[model samples]
Structure formats: structure tokens, C-alpha cells
Target: MLSSKIIMTPKVKISYILNIIIVLVSFTFGFRYIFASAPLNYQLEAIGVHGWNDIIPEYRNMITTFVRVAGVGMTTASIGMSIVLFRAFRYGQNWARWGFAGIFLAHYIPLMCNMFFLKTTTESNPPMIPNLIAISIVLLSLFFSSNLKNCKAIENK
Candidate 1:
């Protein structure tokens, strides 16, 4: 009997490890927002009158509510995508590679823009440099690795 097992190349192994990193990073952000939102809000309030309080009272409330809701929503979505991508990539699904790359770009482009353009201080930018680097590695691994091509061929077989 012939074995049907797919051999994981080094690139595939690296991609898998990077995928796990992305999953951990996503869950960390989700839980951080879910648990620390109150303290975060307080810190934002303490920044100055030019911060959250500058807007009208009703608008400020609305904005705060929107932010909290969006944070939770993004957290859930990130986690969900992490799980889906993890499973798909384990089986060498080509779509998983593209999906992860697309999702990373979608989430981070605006985040990087905010970090670079909107935030004025290191304190305000959050500790996202490592996460950004991990994400970049995942993208590069997906795009340039021969393992992804092998995966695509396997999927088509």
C-alpha cells in the first residue's frame, strides 16, 4: 500500500509556525481589548481636554460606544479568521495562504497608517512593532515560499 501522507517542507513548517504566531497575536489583541478596555478608556480620558472630551457630550458618548463595539467586533473576527486559516493551512489549502495574506493586509494597513500618521508619541502608538514584523514575515513566507506552490499543486490534484 502506498502512503498518502503529505510531507511538510521547511517552508511549509515556517509558514505553519508563522500562522501560529498570527493566531496568538490575534487572540492577545482580542483579550486585551475585552479585559482592559476600562483602563484604556480612563487613560484616554486622562490625556487632556483635547482628547475624548473635545467632542460634544452626546457625540463623545456615541464615539466611545462605537469604539468599544468595533474593538469587540474586530477581536472576534480576527480570532475566527485565525482558526479558519490554521485549519486550512494544515491541509495545505492554497486559498488559506491567500486568505491569510489578504486578511493581514486588510487589518494592518490602516493600523500602520494610524501608528505612523495619527499617533504622535510612542506611548500613544501601542506596542505593535513585533506584531507588525510577525505579520510581515507571514506575508512574505506565503508569497515567496515554494511550499505555497506545492500546496496549490496538491490542491489541484
Candidate 2:
């Protein structure tokens, strides 16, 4: 029988750790959106709409559905991105690096933009600190791991 355990190099290990952190952050916010009402209520309260569920139950449900959809998007996107990172990005695949960055930015940048728009238009401060941290981690991973000059050496091993 042949063994099939995989070993991680230092660079790959760093990428793996950072990718895990990104996924965890996404999961945390995703589950919160899906399971909790506090975050939605906070935004509602910010716009001077207290007891949103009591006042407009149907509207509340609609908004909650949107939030939950976003949560699902975040969780799903992170899982997909992690797969790419683990299988290809950490292996110095340039195409994987670009694909990950493009998909991640496409998914997250709009979210941040919506938060900013909400803050400016409705004075609602959505929780975006975690997202900013995740973006920073993503940038760090991409910037540090993007050097593919040694990819040939890695493949030769």
C-alpha cells in the first residue's frame, strides 16, 4: 500500500493558516446573519425604526431574507475560495492566485460598499471591522505568496 499524506512547506503553511482565518471570519458573520436578529435590529434601530419585527413583520422578513442570503453567500464563497487556495494557490499557481483575488474581491467589495452606502445614507453602522481585517489578511496572503519564480523548483521536488 502506498501512503498519501501531504507535507506543507513553510510558505504553504502560512497561506493555509491565513486561509483558515478568512474562512472562520466568514463563517462567524454568516452564522450570525442566519441565526441572530441583533445585527439586523441594530441597523433597523439606527434608522429610527425600533421593534421592526413588531411594526412591519412582512418587511422584516423580507429584509431578513436578504441578510440570510448574504450570509449564505459569504459562507459558500469562503469554502470555495479555501479549496482553491489549498489545492492550487499555495502551490504557486499564478492563475489560481488571480482567480482567487478576483472572485474574493468581487464578493467582498460590494458588501463593504453597501455598508458604506448604508452608513452615509441611513446613518446605520454595519459591522465591517471584521471584513476589513479579512481583506487585510487576504492582501497579505496574496502579496506574500504571489512570487512564482520558484514554482518550477517546487514542482521539481
Candidate 3:
């Protein structure tokens, strides 16, 4: 129920390029912040932060594992998203929208939870870059996905 909209017009191409630009800007900052927080500590293990680990030793390991896993996910999703955006910038497409949505869905894993569970509001914590990116991605995806829907009805037999 989807197809590329590249042949539409030059206007559409420009629009898609603009959208991809926004997506790339958001994704870059989001990925950077996410990886910084959950840096890969392959050299050491279980360097749990204080005021939380005493009650749950398992929590430390769980968190460490989760961080590593999340990092992998984010990296993969980021690469996929970049591909979609690059395609959109070059060729334009309905798939770009759904592809962006997939990125948002992938981002919601650790990205959303971290914002929800670790929001300190103390001015010391980094801003919610991933959260904002996630929101933008979803919004953009739904917008373009709707356009694809209309095209699908006409294009499909």
C-alpha cells in the first residue's frame, strides 16, 4: 500500500529534501546524546552509579546489559534512518515516511524510557534530544504516510 512519489514533481522533491534535512538534524543530535549517556564500557563492567544499586545488585547488571543492547539498537536504527532520508533527499518516496516511523518506533525503546524514568528537571541533566527527535519522526512519518495512502489507492489495481 505504498510507493515512491519521486515522479510527482520538483516541488515534491524539494519538500522531501527539506523533511529529510530536518530528520537528519534531529537524528544526529539524538544519537550522539544517547550514546554518550550509555557509553560502551567494554574495558570495565558493572560501574553502577550510587544511590540506586545497593537495593538491587541485579539491577546493575540489568541496566548495563540494557544500555549495551539499546546502544546497538540505536546505532542500527540510525543507519537505517540515514539511508531512508538519503533516499528521500535524492529520489523522494512514500517509503521514506514509513521508514522514518520505523526509526521512531526503534527509538522509543530506551529513548522513551530514559526520558520517563530519569527526568530529573534539576538543570543538570542533558536536554531530551532523543525524545524530541522521536516526536518529530512520528509526526513526519504520519504526515507523509497519509500522502502515500492516497497515492496507493490510485496506483494500485
Q: State the lDDT of candidate 2 residue by residue for 81-112, as single tens digits.
A: 87777666655566666666666788999988
Sort by lDDT, best first.
Answer: 2, 1, 3
Query: Per-residue CA lDDT of candidate 1, range 1-157, in tens?
Result: 1122245677777777777777677767666655542335433533434455465677666555655664675586577668656566566666777777777677767766655653564335444576578667877668544465474323324
Estimate every model's Cα lDDT from 0 to 1. 0.61, 0.69, 0.52
Stretches of candidate 1 exceeding 4 Å from the true structure: 1-5, 39-67, 120-123, 151-157
- In candidate 2 the C-alpha lDDT for residue 118 amounts to 81
Which residue pairs in candidate 1 have backbone atoms (N, alpha carbon, C) closer than 3 angstroms, thus clashing? none
Deviation in angstroms for 152 in model 2? 7.1
Better of 1 and 3 by lDDT: 1
Model 1's C-alpha root-mean-square deviation from the true structure amounts to 5.5
How close is each model in CA RMSD to the real structure? 5.5, 4.0, 7.5
At residue 3, give the lDDT of candidate 1. Answer: 20
Q: Which is the better candidate, 2 or 3, if ranked by TM-score?
A: 2
Full ranking by TM-score? 2, 1, 3
TM-score, every prediction: 0.67, 0.78, 0.48
